[model samples]
Target chain A: MTGSEVKKLFYMENKKGVLGKLKDGLLKTRRNLTERIEGVFGGRIDAQALEDMEEILITSDLGVKASKEIIGIIERTDPVNLRETLKGEIFNILKKGEASLLTNGHKPAVIMVVGVNGNGKTTTIGKLAKRFKDEGKEVLLVAGDTFRAAAIEQLSVWGERVGVKVVKHKSGADPGAVVFDAIQSEKAKGADVVIVDTAGRLHTKAPLMEELKKIKRVMDKELPGAPHEVLLVIDASTGQNAIEQARIFHEAIGVTGIVLTKLDGTAKGGIIIAIIRELEIPVKMIGIGEKIDDLRDFNAEEFTEALFE
Target chain B: MFEGLTNKLEGIFRKLRGRGILKEEDVLSALKEIRLALLEADVNFKVVKDFVERIKGRAIGQEILQSLTPGQQVIKVVHEELTSLMGESYKKTHLSPNPPTVLMLVGLQGSGKTTTAGKLANLFKKEGRQPLLVAADTQRPAAIEQLSLLSSQIGVNFYGTKDGDNPIRVCEDATHKAKREGFEPVIIDTAGRLHIDDALMDELKMVREKILPHEILLVADAMTGQDAVNIAQRFDEALNLTGIILTKMDGDARGGAAISMMAVTGKPIKLIGVGEKLDLLEPFHPNRMASRILGMGDVLSIIEKAEASIEKEEALRLEKKLGTDSFTLEDFRGQLKQMKKMGPLSQILDLIPGLGKFRSEINIDDRELIKVEAIIDSMTKKERGNYAIINGNRRKRIALGSGTMVTDVNRVLKQFIQVKKMMKAFSRRPMGGKGGLNIAREVMKWQ
Candidate 1:
């Protein structure tokens, strides 16, 4: 699509109720103020123009801290080129804290997917396995979610489609034992990466969480530093609640990075900005569609621009 | 918002509320309520099973039973477990140190991708960042136009050619433009298909390769319920998503999507769209959200909104008056005005913990509020401060002047008297200490 066409897509009117209305209002106000400021300045920066810009920023839902920092930079910078300078300052703040995707230099980087039930943990692992397999890496799937009968079968189905080997036990088996076996099998087969899928349980369930922790411990013991990446999968559709989910998972088991799934669904994608603003955790990847290749590495600047667009 | 769950919980808790200790059966009954609520909310069945088991384990423990207030202790346990079930800490998005950090927007058709892109850009623009918008969704009719319009609306720079082109190419070019133009953040809006189609996957892969975005955000609609979780799984498998944004939370959705989606998909929900407006977006907070879902009003959030809307000194002054039972109709009008400032009455009502169940029953229509305001407007300044002066004749006159019926005015007066009496009794109650006055003070300060 042409850049203009892409921009048009980004600007589509959100029909959903209050959220849509709020977004439209903020954008409209910002646009009007920006135009007014630009008209007044005529490409020249002035103190009044700076103040107007600050109001615009504050109105755009940028938190007070970030807005103040931006304003501070604009106040301190050369007035003649204030707008660009302010933009540059805000960009710097957004770019400050970012985490990279999992890359352990091992023959097969072991990424053990962790998350509660219905957070798309199993499917994400399946997709990750497929992505690695498509990249010509020897990938193995281990169904550690022994609690659910369908979960193991689900991973097995994905494993077959992705042309990867899946290791699983019967229903009601030990998840830790399953991971241990999968790792041993992968090592024996000289696999490039081993992706383990564990049972989905609430982070609140201490015993279940303990079980997951135990599984991680066993995986590490079997293959030292084996579960190199504990990618916490979260559903993007949960809106602000996703932040809470991230917190619980991180506390129960250290989450190295996050895999945000289902971005293609809601206008609340702006929550990512809030997450970054509040938690400062780096998002490793995002899922936009239900395809093996939909998982892509996260880019904050691109995300910010797409959101505004 | 959480009225359904809260009502179920309250019914179960009512039996245990007055009791000093909660027996195993009492905990079991509450768990049953939780179980039903979870199921109704479309939480994954397996997750619910494990959750109930965990809660049961803690509830049956000797420590809880031996507590001074076992019922409250059990409730606290449930609340804490629920909060933990979500997540304990806020996870921030990972921003790259490099300039032109790419963020890709992805979602299924009708998922509000374009709108979310605009909201995100506006968010960054508020941060004073020069964000470049990339229209990468080429297949959908008017997709690029939609994005362009949003970018202009948000006053952000748009990057994309007019000619029909591949989305990946547009992203590549947009990245180049962002770099050349010195834009620090670049947002790419990608195409989405009805289901997980191969063509769409290939296009997303191409775009990912071209842009190598710093963050890949998946936008999902909360109204889709369990399907949202499945869709998220598919997307995560394909794109290795970095974060998630749930849209359309302002609707009548039971918020099952929020719970089930999170349980099924491990991606952190970065933001929530409470309304369609650019400013309606808010950062996800688990504790507040848990309380919201439990049918417990988020007092802190309510206070924050109130603080934002009203002067702190005025709020404090009003609080003091409420404490002494000196709150008058003038204060009532002020409170009404404050409620108006917060949002629509119905919307505010939804935020009340247990009141959600009666939302439909209690028609807090704006028209009714307007009628009340009109009646209050007709009152003399003296009568407003001292409602005792509002005699029957004056009530009829005020009703006529306000364009409301005498019955409506009488109803308002009666309700007012009840409120006054309740406030007086509340102030005199010895327990009206810190906790007792909290709800009453909040209600009085609503304006």
Candidate 2:
């Protein structure tokens, strides 16, 4: 779909505001990339133009492997139509990862948020909680990050800010127990959605991965197909190692979607395009800033527009 | 993190091995691989271009040496370029001559400023100085609480105002408190902010103006991508940072941010966070990291840590065996016994391939080491020297003798093979200390 078509069809929440926010949000990345390829796609067939175009995309954090693939695909097309061909290739891949979270599934549908340390997991949860609460759903945030100091407190502050009740325990309590307890009581509490805030861990830590698996197992036992969404929150600034994070975490815990956090900054979460192209994990959301209102659903057209802007 | 880059470089060099001289085509293809590897490592595009250009200049037709393989010659040039680009000298946080040295930590959001504050305090506290951790991060929710909790964990003094709405006021209050409490070094943990955020940048400038920090450290994530250089430059322009503390170095990020930041800002990384624990902070060694990026393990860091637990002679012997590729299962067993004294085998074993992929938890620490040791002990002398001879039947027998599962024996054998190859990778020559460049350079003189 074209950028305007998607903007018109989708974005019922903030048709005007979303685009404005995204424009400003991606200003740095836009300036960096848009300026690099300003004269690239306009010329007749020139190998220099294509090489520079590939470099622009790679420099914007699209990754070497993905950039090479896209460049190769674009090379087959006539140079005069490079922009349309490139956009088409990106839109095709972006479309694969554009689904939103399963918001209307089972009542009190569970959303498990996970990532390596300091990738804005708690902040993303706060924003998600605000969104769900704004939608008039009874949101219950479970503090499953018992590892980091004040992690529970961080989630609690988000809950307080968003006007939702949080299920939590003291730091160092068993996270699986917390998840089990949250799941068991959600129906009685009349909660319409449960967002799990898990401890940030590198996927390379096998035991931590096992713990996450245990948490999933406990959830499934308590409610089959619980944790309907396992969202991996990747910092936009994260480099090539994000591939490993996506691979291992998906292998260990079966990640259903990815939330690209801190996209408001200059670090193009362009890696998500790479992740989706390689791993097929849907891009459910993009966290624009630290504020509760800074999050937006992953719109393929909007994301590609921002990247190619 | 660097395994991919090293493997590619090694493969490219291996293709050119046994050649007495570097052909023009060989160097061009090798330069292409090096360019891709650097880009994949997330080094800044501009920096990568300059780097590849330099390598091309140094590795072209006239640069070949008769005494070395084409691979060795290219590697020597590449290693020198990496080390020079990263700044060859090591550095630490600049402590003032006067007491109450102030260090202001600043960076982008979630760049680990608060955690690095704790680590810096902990490191200095271990040195017998009472370092105060100041939680001036008033923006993020519960950031102050996190720093306060870290201070308590580190058993060092902490200074934070619960209702200090302004971070400048908070730093002002914290510096006074540090002076009053005899906290020798005041670590002001400023809130992480986007470099483009003018208001927050101004706030940091105000905090610096008020506290007059002896050192302004930009705590950055080693996993940061191309924006790492831009982020560092902006912060350096705003705050004129004294150094950097790179966190999450333990993770499998190629840590290209380290190279990018140092190259752009010309700032030395003072410390690195290698693990989650506060005590996992260690001095930054540029040469070791440079060597590491080139696929040479951080042999000096490992040898130095080992020296603390084992006798100097034993440490030297272990180093010799590794350099000579004579490290056997028996030597592995002996090292395990001594490594037990150095703390968790997994942490020290990050330099070891395969076994380090997943540094097991504490519960799996010494127990796994003991099982592997027993499996090795159950092996015959010849089997110890040659791990390949341990067949399925032998693995079952070793498992029975060690009173463990056969899978345990299999894992030990796998680890032995990996460790064997890992040692061979480090065996080009003695890796630690100076004169490391001379072997290739020294050989070049014979040309």
Candidate 3:
């Protein structure tokens, strides 16, 4: 068949897989928050009922501020359309902050991924490399997280799996030098996109935060206006600390967007609303599973719909 | 990023203290703040609700109403209740009387099970117990290598099957080897899936049945809020865990999971992994954790009691605190409070009238001491010394500042004069007689 027909066929198969993973990853969140709200609707909408709904939402890792805001909307609106009112309000928060990766137009668009340890910085890089490669781009993986012992090897494993080239140094080498080398390699090979993975360092660690700044400076020196997107990967299960982490990292390095990972592992995926409302940073992707295909470009409507379904 | 939960709770109580009496409304308002603080710290909502309710029940009762320091009494109740909620006492992992105690570490992916397994092996090795690291987590990419690397770093014996061996078979074979090799603690690090699936659970169940580990320790990431509690509960339902090992204590987690995990799962947290280092493992203590959460500063009283019972090196540290000029107003406040807790002074004085020679060593009643503290608290650093410089105007300002009358300030000044005279006399006591030597030795007991 022709190119457009092949693209349509792939989209047909990929869309089904994407929705399936979304539903699976958000199943616990739906059961814990949305389903509980559905049960509340079967009764009178009173102060007690509204408090119960508020508890469910807040306990789902949605901060007290956002949960109360939604509860206020539910209480003020007509009771007959409570679910729509709540969903619409949540959709508004996420819809306004919607963003996608800026990998187009720029040559070898550099994206820097940063977050605290175990928030899946390395794994998400692996998935991003795979996705960009699947889109027929020349992708080069840069192992910029030189602090962690297995981080280099971890990204290299993904590089091998996705059939992409991973530029790395020794475990304790300066991460800026590694990024410099990767950018040099990308220039020589005329790569389409370069995704860099930084070590999983806490925002509280000043030296590590300084290291991230140095790496960004090195990227700019090599290719001015490089690192087009600085993505912060946050674990879905993290509570209010996720906001603090995002705020500090954004202040330190000006994070462009977020990648919420380990969605399937938590019932508190409601932290998504908290992050969006508090940070105003767009969530570019959601990690639904451990597999490469589990990471999907975020759709605000699909995410809100999956919560109810 | 991480401060004492007690500081926030105490901020609420500081407001209540201004009210003079503990009313039900005051208790309710303070409980509301406590609930939010606990929730923000990632404590389970159910646990936070129950914890606040319990504190409110005790706080609004006659105990707080009748107590002289009602606000402090409420805080004490919170500290006590928090300690009980997190498991009343410290619990050590039970070692089997028989040799080769097998421990199977299981959790979701990225929960630090493999790293904790290495830490546990290193700890047992430091205790002079032989430990074998069993690499049964053959699923995740490089999981086996990660565990083996940790083993080599700590120089512990490791057991692993060749490529493509089922985890259950690997665990079984590893245990067999551990027993034959005389390893006292066999740590079986099992595989973890990104999410809990029946396939993964069934495989873990198979490993559990085959190995029949003496202790099934759940290694959970402490930063996971309510999910850690749910994971602990689910794992407990499946594996019947012996204890929990909370990893990433070094991180700036609100510590909600560490507080709620034991309550939700009804399992003790045997150990905590503070950092990536193998030697950063610490035994979990509920009382000290409660004190730290309340901003009570690690509850040094627990260490003091431990020193009293064990007579360890920590007693020397306490002695230094007492013997040095580092004893400031803050230390005096603590000492005054501790002296009131020591009981009636008349009986002690009747037993030993010679206590007057060693006045600093004596535990005197502090009911009159609180007023002295208020007066001293109002004094500027310069005025705390050179009492002669405190003229009439300064005395009036000091009285107004401390909310005491000028007459009360004068009475405190007069008491300080008498105490100074007595201190001069006691300082001149000769160190030759048996009584003097006995007094010096009695002072050393507390020092």
Worst 10 residues of 2 chain B by lDDT: B435-444
**Best-first order by lDDT:** 2, 3, 1
Please write out the lDDT profile of model 1 over residues A1-309, one tens digit for every residue.
Answer: 354654354334335443333333234323444565465446556666665664455333242345556677777777777655754554554564356756558866788888644556765776687667767888888888776434676677678757888888986799888887877773525888888888766453456677878998997887787678888887654434455556767777788877777554432233344456666766787765454555666665644433333
Candidates 1 and 3 compared: the better one by TM-score is 3
- TM-scores of chain A across candidates: 0.71, 0.91, 0.92
Better by lDDT, candidate 2 or 1: 2
Q: Candidate 3 lDDT, tens digit per residue, A11-52?
A: 343455767778877887777777688888777888878878
lDDT of 2 by residue, A1-309 (tens): 232432232223454498888777777777777676667866765778877977787777889999999998887888777877887898899999989788676876889998999898888898888888888898999999999988898889778868899998889999999998888883425988899999989876677888999999998898888888999999999988898899999999899999898887888777887899999999998887655678888899987788677
- TM-score winner between 2 and 3, please give it: 2
Model 2: per-residue Cα lDDT over B15-73, one tens digit each: 77757766788788888988888899898888999999998887885666443566787
Measured with C-alpha atoms, the lDDT of residue B133 in candidate 1 is: 80
> How close is each model in CA RMSD to the real structure?
26.3, 8.5, 13.3
Q: Name the regions of candidate 3 deviating beyond 4 angstroms.
A: A1-17, A186-188, B1-4, B162-164, B299-447
Give, for candidate 1 chain B, the lowest lDDT window spanning 10 residues. Answer: B431-440
Deviation (Å) of B78 in candidate 2: 0.5
Ranking by TM-score: 2, 3, 1
